[model samples]
Target chain A: MSGAGHHRNAELQARVNRLLDLAESRGVITRGQVDARIEAFGDRVTARNGADMVVRAWNSPEYRERLLADAGAAAAELGHAGGGYSSDIRLHAVANTPTVHHVVVCTLCSCYPLAWLGPPPAWYKSEAYRSRVVRDPRGVLREFGLVLPNSTEVRVWDASAEARYLVVPQRPPGAEELSEDAQRDLVTRDCLIGVAVPRLPAEVSR
Target chain B: MSFAVGDRVRVLTMNPPGHNRAPRYVRGHVGEVVRLVGDGRFPDESAVIGDAARREDIVTVAFAGPELWGPDSHTGDRVHVDLFVSYLEAVGERSDGGRTR
Candidate 1:
């Protein structure tokens, strides 16, 4: 299924269009408002915000301490406070240790860290991913091209509550030689989600 | 009842008639309290009563893969779930009907 609600079945599309029309006619909300909201989210709340946090944490131990303690406030300090429509939303940062790795999923629905990461990917909202990731995390990570050692423990986080999860992957070696902007580029969305780790340019070449 | 971090708790095996946040797979499984994830409005009650429901404590519980899915699961994998306190109970006391641990 498309994450942006595109290419759906015609019957479902028609029903959704009817509901939208009815709501617009009753002054519930306008199509323009909906478009504006999506645009705002795309522009302001993209995954780059999460990359920025990870990059900052990579450089500053103080900021990393603050982020792990109060993720919501730390995000807000960087101007990425993204609760959107609910005051109940909270962001939690789970750091990867030498023996432990963290990956997040929402089993019931597509609940994600939308405030910091903007919209979720199409695969994240799929039934196959939601059902299988918790059961066979290593298999799923393998499919994503991540092969962890048997000694390393995989921790699959099933997010069923209002709190959102962000994975803080270990910084790649030789990251200190790069500029801040360069470091940010290595911290991709996949790295932030813990499916893949950031790789230095030299490491990638090797 | 309140539980400190590192306490062992088991999820209640329940199939309630209304909306609930606890997933079916983790029901009746044992886990350790990893962190207290703050309180929020109870999903089951809030889904029925809307804004009038009371808030409840939430925690991040970590369960071994083998404990949840049996021996076929990965050897060193663990699953962490953010669950309401109401969905948990003393682990050893449930099946045996013995005194609370």
Candidate 2:
């Protein structure tokens, strides 16, 4: 479970361990608490939560309206109350249309929708991604293997405040015939982050 | 509370020594207000004052790539940042006076 194996930042790893040690020695927090929080993030809180919301919205027009209108409330409707972090941290869903695409980022820091979509990927927290995505979104999307058409407007959401964003990608073609669960399978974590779009099962293998 | 959706505004250019959430990339740039994300504890005050810090309204501002990064940026791309009210100032309308504000 430790990142010392291939994390590439031994100095930061040591510092984090030192801080955790200090907190433990001072009785501020027990190791069990830390492990529990990690386990929760690693297991209970995953992208499946966001996929559930996205899947529901795709199936029902009224739910889609509610999701776009008030994402936090709609998330709670599906049991993702988005609790734990500051109550002010609101979850907002931005749906990608045929002409407009949406990507989320936090230039100041990695302010992701952890409560609804689990922790962000490591690349998302890197300085390279943070700084470049805002300035050259199309280029970065290309690096992610997402080549949008010139006419498709890219909307990069820089989550600089407590407002966290969840990108609701439009359901891909050939997926409408699939069941709800199958459709949810197509909505991968990258799709939720907007770095990639959902692909049909057959397209994925190709 | 001061600005609404479609309001043309500019990010105040300042190098305040205090803690601020406004990123350096957005400072001094012009943008249009898009969404009003409800009030929350102002980060500048919260950094020094903690939970008791004064609250302020936060709004999402849409910045075109050209305005932030010049011509090399993709023509159809845009960045939307959620900035506090204190970090923005009214720039009235778009300079072109033709684009939808």
Q: Could you say which candidate leads in lDDT?
A: 2
Candidate 2 displacement at residue B4 in angstroms: 1.1
DockQ for candidate 2, C-alpha atoms: 0.86
lDDT of 2 at B66: 90
Task: State the lDDT of candidate 2 residue by residue for A89-128, as single tens digits.
Answer: 9999999999999999888988999887788787888788
DockQ of each: 0.86, 0.86
Task: Assign candidate 2 its CAPRI class.
Answer: high
Candidate 2, superposed: residue stretches over 4 Å from native: A1-8, B93-101
CA RMSD per model (angstroms): 2.6, 3.4
TM-score per model over all chains: 0.93, 0.92
| Fraction of native contacts under 8 Å reproduced by each candidate | 0.90, 0.96
Instruction: Report the lDDT tens digits of candidate 1 across residue range B1-101.
Output: 78889999989989999999999999888899999988999999999998799999999999999888889998799999999999998665456674333
